[model samples]
Every structure is written in structure tokens, then in C-alpha cells.
Target: MARRYDPDRRTRIIDAALRVIVADGIAGLSHRSVAAEADVPLGSTTYHFGSLDELLTAALRRSNENFAQALRDSEVCAGDADGGEGASSGARLADELTRVLGEWFAGERGAIELEYELYLAALRRPALRPVAAEWTTSAVELLSTRTDPATARALVALMDGVCLQVLLTGSAFDAEYTREMLTRVVDGCA
Candidate 1:
């Protein structure tokens, strides 16, 4: 019989792999574990992904897709706060931007933890480098729409740092507190 592609099975395995990665981190992922978690035959793991590195690459790509979509959704929801035509004036946009940034930092930490695992994996595998680089560039471009390139990059770094702080400290990194600091850095460039 000719080989057939089973998209659903592949997706199921990938989803299970993500859960495993989230719970145990990347180093703990294995085809056997993923198969058991996916409730598929061990052979099914090899059938879908030729090797462990390939499976991890797919999982990281999936993480990239999921995180990008989450940010897009957050942007849409936050945009609704912009009153109407003249709704978001100068200071308003800045405030709304900070609020949006806070919401993202609060809500997206889990995804970042997954990303942290993916990044560590990427360090060992060159094949995954493109995915990591593309994710970073795409994220920067998304931020650039709201601020200049330099400020956007800075904001990305700040968000990453603040999210890490919150994750490590188990406390909220209030955007309001960072607003003046970020605004000063952003406005300083002009």
C-alpha cells in the first residue's frame, strides 16, 4: 500500500509533544513518552517524525505559530479599547500600548517558557535556527508598527525581561510602573 499522510495524527502527536515539553521541558521529551502521551503506537512516532530532532523542530514551529496567533488576538482585543476616530491620541496610544504590553506579559508567560525550551534546543541543532530567527524578526516587525525599530527592539527586550522577572518572582510586573521608564526611553530617541 502507498504511504498516506494523516494530518490529524500528526497534529495529535505534536499537541502531545507540546504538553510534554511544557510539563517536563525539552530535555525530558522522548518519542516513547510522546507516543504514550499521544496514545499511539511507538512505531507511530517514527512513522510521523524520522528522529527526535525533527519532532522537536516541529514542536518549536508549532510554538511559534501558537505564540504569534496569541499576540495577534491580544492586539485585536486591546485595539477595541481605542475609543474611535480620534480615540488614541499621543499619550493615549502610549498608555494603551503599555496596557497591551502588560496584558501580554501576564498572559503569555507559559508560551515563553515553552519558547525558552525551544531556544535551548535550537542552540544544539542548526536546522532549527531559521525558525528561531524568523520568530524573532517577525515579532520585532509586529512591534515596529507601534514604535520605531530601535524602540520596538528595546520594548521586546523589556517585555522579555519583565516576563522573566514575573515568572521567577511570582509577582506581577505592572506595566504602569514600567510605563514612565519605557516612555522615557522611547521619547528620548526623538
Candidate 2:
């Protein structure tokens, strides 16, 4: 008799790969490790992903999709804010961005680490570069809804720097400081 195929197996493998990457870093990823992590047979890993690079790319894509969805759900965009009669749209945009960053720093440190790992991996893997690029594009597009392209790019860079600093120092992320910095960026754009 033929073996049954699990429809969700591919997603499970991708999610397991992310867990492995978060726990052991990108250097530690392997078909066997992912299979063990997913509790699937090794053949499943190979069958779903022809190569480790393919697997890593899929994992990064999945991570990016999840992160983007979280950002969307957080309503970080200007449209979601209740801009009162007197509230400056720019200020509201900055506040929303600061809230998003604070939530990300407070809750998604592991995912952020995985993002950085994938970013570094992309530096070496040409195919993975597009994944990183797409992530950046998505962020910039989100920001561009409230600001110009230049300011959007600058805000994205600032957010990346702040995230890295918070991650590196192992210090508590200060939302007020982030808000102040982002407000300055928004003001400069005006």
C-alpha cells in the first residue's frame, strides 16, 4: 500500500526549520535537523525542498510573511489611526510606527533574530537576496503610505538600527525613546 501524504507537511517543515534556525542559527540548519524538529521523516524534507538553500529560502519567506501579517494586524499604517481634529497626520504616523516598533521589540525578539540571520545569509546567497529585498520593500511601502519615499526608507533604516541595538545590548526596549526618534524623523521629513 502507498503511504499517506500530509497536506500540511510542507508548512510544518518550514515552521520547524524556523524554530531550528532560531534555536541554533542559520549555520545549524539541515534536512535531518528540520525533519527531527518537525517530527517528520527525513525523506519528507528532501521531498518538499530539493536543496538546503531552497529550504532556507522558503523558511525566510514564511518568516517574512508572518512578520508582515503581524505588522498589518497591528495597524501600524496611518489609515488605522484615529487622527483627531487637531492631530497632525505626521505625528500620528510617527506614534503608530513607534507603537509597532515597541510591540515588535517587546514580543518578537526571536523572529527579529531570525530576520537578522536570514539577512546575513542573504549576503552570501544570491537567491535569498530577493527575500530580504521583498521584506524591505514591504516595510517601505507600508511607511510610504504616510511619508515620502526617502523618509520611508530612512525610517526603515532607523528602525533596523534601533532593533539591532536593542537586540545587541539585551536591554529593555524603550518605547518613549523610539517614539522620540521617530517623531524627529517624521518632523525632518516635513
Candidate 3:
């Protein structure tokens, strides 16, 4: 058989890995499984990633962008391009953050579960710890634009806690509660 060429194989493999994780979780991941999901040869998965950790690292790196990109695309986080420089007021920041959180929670449950699963995997997999931290770093960086770095870090922690609560408890997201907590963080209040 002639050697085939596929520039998108790597990206497709990474995407497939995420889908596999979403469907079966970290325990279900294997190069063979990922290759089957990606519709690529098993060798392709090994060629791209020598181990499950490497594949997971790539998958997690990709997943981290989903929420950060959402935050980046937010109106307050992006700021007003039309000279509305003050639009990121604490109140406005809180409001936009809340809205964004609601949107995140409203997304597909599998996707949400995949993201959290990747983060939780860090508890046992040392390689994934930095990727989890990277998720926090990106969110804090996006938020720091609207508030001080300290406040931004606090807000990220707050959001993470709130999200964890909603996910673990199977409770519906409360935008009002999120808004109030975010406001307190943005305002530097205890």
C-alpha cells in the first residue's frame, strides 16, 4: 500500500480523543480506542503521541481553549471597540461573567463533563496538573483585564468552585447566585 498523506490527522486525532473521553472518560482512553474513534490507523495515534498522557495533554490543551475563548469572546472581556472603555465596570464585569457562566453550563453536558473530567484527572496524573493550572491561568489572564490580577485570580477560584458545585450536585445553575458571588470578588469584598 502507498503511504498516505494527511496534514489534519493530528488535529483529528486530538478531537477524537476528546470525544472518546466525553463518551467513556479517562479510564476508557487508549491509543487503539482513539485511533478507532479518529478513523485513523493505530500507528497514527502512536506516531503522534507515544502514550496516553501525551494524548491527554494534547486533548486537554485543546479543551482549555473552549472556556477561555468563550470568555475572550465575551463583550466585557473583549471590551468595547467603539470607545466604550468603561464598559467593564465591576457591576458590568460581574454581569458579563455571570452571563458567560450561564452559557457554559447551558452547553452540552457531555462537553462540560469532559472538561471537568480532564481537570479531575490531574488529581492522579501528574502530567495533567499543569494543563489544569493552565486553564486557571488563561481564565485569570482574561479576567485581569477587567480587574486587578488578585481579584481576577479570586474570581477564577470562585467560578471554579461554583461550577464544581453545580456539576457534582446535579443542580441547575443559578445566575443570580453567580452574579452575586462574582460581584463580591470583583468588588474586593470578603
Candidate 4:
């Protein structure tokens, strides 16, 4: 065969990389591993990704977009932005945040952990910082419409902490507690 044409090869590779990361953590990723996971030739991975960092950057960026889309797609959260009708006491916003967190935690825990692993990987991989930040900025921008940017940042931080806590400690996600805590923040700002 002279050459094979696969339009979605790059995407498949990135998706495969995600799966590998999810299964083995970022530490276990490598061109050989991704090629095996993608079922493509090793050269294909290198051709598509000049370096492991480049490949990670692509995977993290795609993962970030997925998370951003989740927030963008949530009607419940959107409704609370801008205080819904008139002025909001932050209850609705808090409720929305709590609900969103509940849904996130309810999702496949491994995938969530993998996403955070990619984010935390930024600590060592400077190339991934922008990709990780994109998720935060996207979340903040979405939340900013409901409240000031400062409050939005605070909310993001709180959500991150709660999410990490749940993941690290293997504890149950308490929706009521989350709602109350978020409400206090929103209420204080209100």
C-alpha cells in the first residue's frame, strides 16, 4: 500500500490518548503506548504529534472543551445567570452550582480524575498551563454573567476544592452541603 487515507486519524489518536491517560494516568503515556492504543502505526503518532507535550496539549485542550461545553449546555445553570428575571439573592445561582457539581461527581469518577490529572500535570508541564487555564477561564466567564467576575472566580475555586476533596478522600458528594456552602458565598456577595 502506498498511502492510506483516514480523515479522522488525528482525532482518533487524540481520543486514544485520552483513553490511555484515563487508564494509566499521564505518567504511563508515550508515543508507543498511544500508537498501540490507537491501533495505528507508531510513526503515525509521531507524525501527528511532534512530541509528548504536543500530544498532551491536544488531549487536554479537547478535554477542556468537553468540560466547557458541559457548562454551556446546562440549562439549569444558564437560567440562574444574570439573576434569572430580576435580582437574585444567589440562592438560584448556588442551587445551580450545586446541581452542576452533583452531576459532575455523579459522572464516571475515573474520567473526572483523569481530567484533573491533566490539569494538575500543568504543574510540571508548562506547555499544558494554557490548556488547563482555558477550562477555568471558560467556567469563570460563564459564571461571571451571573455574578461579578470575582465571585465567579471564587465559585470556581470552591467547586474545584470540593471536587478534588471528593475525589481524593473517596467521600460521598453531599449535594445539600454543597448547595448551602455555595449559597453562603452567593448570599454574601448579594
Candidate 5:
């Protein structure tokens, strides 16, 4: 006979795993600790996830979903700006990118740190790199439609640099500063 499973309990375990990762880093993740944090029996963890890798995979998927949603939302805002409905005309597109980058950098350091852990894992675990690479590709493709491909790549790089700067220094780079830099870059390319 098959064992019974509690879907809600399973979700709680995964969420707890994420919290543990955020609080203690992925290196510290373990069934006993996660079970303690989730307030579930340790057996429930083994029953729900069978293995640590399985749990991490699920967590990574959840993280990717959140990133995907953010990218889509950013793209929608960019679309509105493209259609001239947002406040800044064509400039609105760049401004939206700046805002998205700022919010992602300043507000979501846990996610960023989680992402760095994922990156280190990807280096050692080949299966994980594509998930992140695909996310980067989608974001770049969205930006490239408004700006040239090369410039779009540069824009993404600048955003990443600004994010790292913020994460390291606790400084908020002004969104307009990026907007102004992109304006000059895009204008010069025209």
C-alpha cells in the first residue's frame, strides 16, 4: 500500500527549507533542522521529500517562479511605457527597468543571497545552471526589444553591478542615475 501524504504539510516543509536557507544559508539545510523549524516530525520531511536534493530542487523551482513573475511584471510595465501610457513616454521603459532593478536589489537581499548560493551550487551541480541562465536570457530578451542586444546586455550588467553595490554597501543607487546613463547610451547608439 502507498503511504499517505499531506500536501499542506509538504508545502510547509518546503517553505521552512527556504527560510532556513535564507537564515542559515543553503549549506546548513538539513532534515532535522528544517523539521524543527517547520514544526513537523522529521519523518514527514523524509516522506515528503525523500532526499535533500529533492527538497533543494523544489526550493530552487519556487525561487525561479518568483523571479519569473518579477520579470513578467517588469516586462508588462515596460510594455505600458512603450505604448506611451506610463508617465515618462519612451523614457518610461528605462525608468521601469531602473525601478525593477532597484526594488530587486534593495528589497530582496535574501533572494539575492539565495541566488548566489544557487550559483555556487550550479557550478558544482551542472543541472542547476540552466535554470538561472534561462532567467537571465528572458530578462535580457525583454530589454533588448527596446534597446540593442549588446546595449541590453550592458544594461543588465549595469543593473547587476548596481545590485551588488547595494548589497555590499547598503547604498541605494538612484533610479534616475541609471536612467540618465541608459539615455546617453541609447541616444549615442541611435
Candidate 6:
């Protein structure tokens, strides 16, 4: 009798690849590793992803989509008050962003690390640049709803810097400090 095929095998392989990337970085990613992580045969990974680059691309795309969804689901700017630029609205935006960042750091720090790994990997691989670009573009688009394009771009950069600092220092994420910085940016944009 033939073996059963899992309909979600591709997704499982992609997710397992992300876990491997998070734990070992892109340098350690391989069909065998992902297969073991996913508890699937090695062939499954190769069948789903013909090469390591393809697997990395899929994993990065999945990771970006998951992070983007988390940002969207947080309703980061859903409470934006309609009217002229006011301190209250700016503060509200900052508070919302702070909350979102806090939650992300508290729960998704590993994923954030994986994201940075993929971003750095893109630096050497020209083909992977599009994945990183898409991730940045998505984040900026999400942020633009709360501020001007230039400020939104700055805020995204700020976010990356802060997250990297926290990750590197292994210190607790300072949401208040983030809020303060975000408020400064939002107020400046107003």
C-alpha cells in the first residue's frame, strides 16, 4: 500500500524551517534539518522546496506574513481620532504602537530574531533582496496609516533598531522608552 500524503506538509515544512532558522540561523537550514524538525521524511522537504534558497524564501515570506498579521490584528492605529493634529491623537498613536511592540517583544522575540537573520542573509544573496524589501514595505505601509510617509519610514527604522538592541542586550524590552520615542516621532510628524 502507498503511504498517505499530508495535505499540510508544505506548510509544516515551511514552519519547521522557520523554527530551525530561529534556532540555528539561515546558515544551518537544510532539507534534512527541516525534515527532522517537521517529523517528515527528507524527501518531503525537497519535494516541497527544491533547494535551500527556495525553502528560505518561503520561510521568510511566511514569517513576514505572520508578523504583518500580528501588527494588523493589534489594531495599532484603529483608535486614531479624526481631526486636526492634536497632542492627544499623537499620544494615542504612540501608546497603541507601544502596546503592539511590547506584545511583540514579549511573545514574538524569537520570530523577530529570525526575521533579522533573513534580512541579513538577504544582504549577500541578491535574489533574497525582494523578500526583505517586501517585509519593509509592508511594515512601512502599515505605519503610514498613523503618520506621514517619511515619519513612517523613520519609525520602522527606529523599531528595527530598538528590537535589535533588546535582542543583543538580552535585557527586558522598555516599552515606556519606546513609547517616548514614538511620541516624539508622532508629534514631530503632526
The candidate scoring highest on lDDT is: 3
Q: What's model 3's overall lDDT? A: 0.89
lDDT of each: 0.72, 0.84, 0.89, 0.86, 0.72, 0.83
After superposing candidate 4 on the true structure, give the runs of residues whose Cα lies further than 4 Å from its correct spot: 80-89
Worst 10 residues of 4 by lDDT: 75-84
| Pairwise lDDT winner, candidates 1 and 3 | 3
lDDT of 6 by residue, 13-70 (tens): 9999999988888878889999999999999898888888889888888878866787
TM-score for each of the candidates:
0.76, 0.90, 0.93, 0.92, 0.73, 0.87
lDDT of 2 by residue, 18-125 (tens): 999999998899999999999999999999999999999998888788667766776566373564457676667777778777777777688888877887698889
Of the candidates shown, which would achieve the greatest TM-score relative to the real structure? 3
Which is the winner by TM-score between candidate 1 and candidate 6? 6
Residue-pair clash count for candidate 4: 0
Q: Which ten contiguous residues of candidate 3 have the minimum total lDDT?
A: 79-88
RMSD of each candidate? 3.8, 2.0, 2.2, 2.5, 3.8, 2.7
lDDT of 5 by residue, 30-93 (tens): 9998999999999999988888877877777677676557767765324543354645533666
Candidate 1 stretches greater than 4 Å from native: 1-5, 75-94, 104-111
Query: At residue 170, what lDDT does model 4 achieve?
Result: 94
Model 6 misplaced regions, further than 4 Å: 1-3, 79-87
- The clash number for model 6 is 0
Considering lDDT, which of the candidate structures 4 and 6 is the better prediction for this target? 4
**After TM-score superposition, what is the CA distance of residue 159 in candidate 2 from its true location, in Å?**
0.7
lDDT of 1 by residue, 1-94 (tens): 9966666998899888998988888777999999999998889989889998889888888888755565566552243354646543334445
Off by over 4 Å in 2: 78-81
Q: What are the clashing pairs of model 3? A: none
Clashes of each: 0, 0, 0, 0, 0, 0
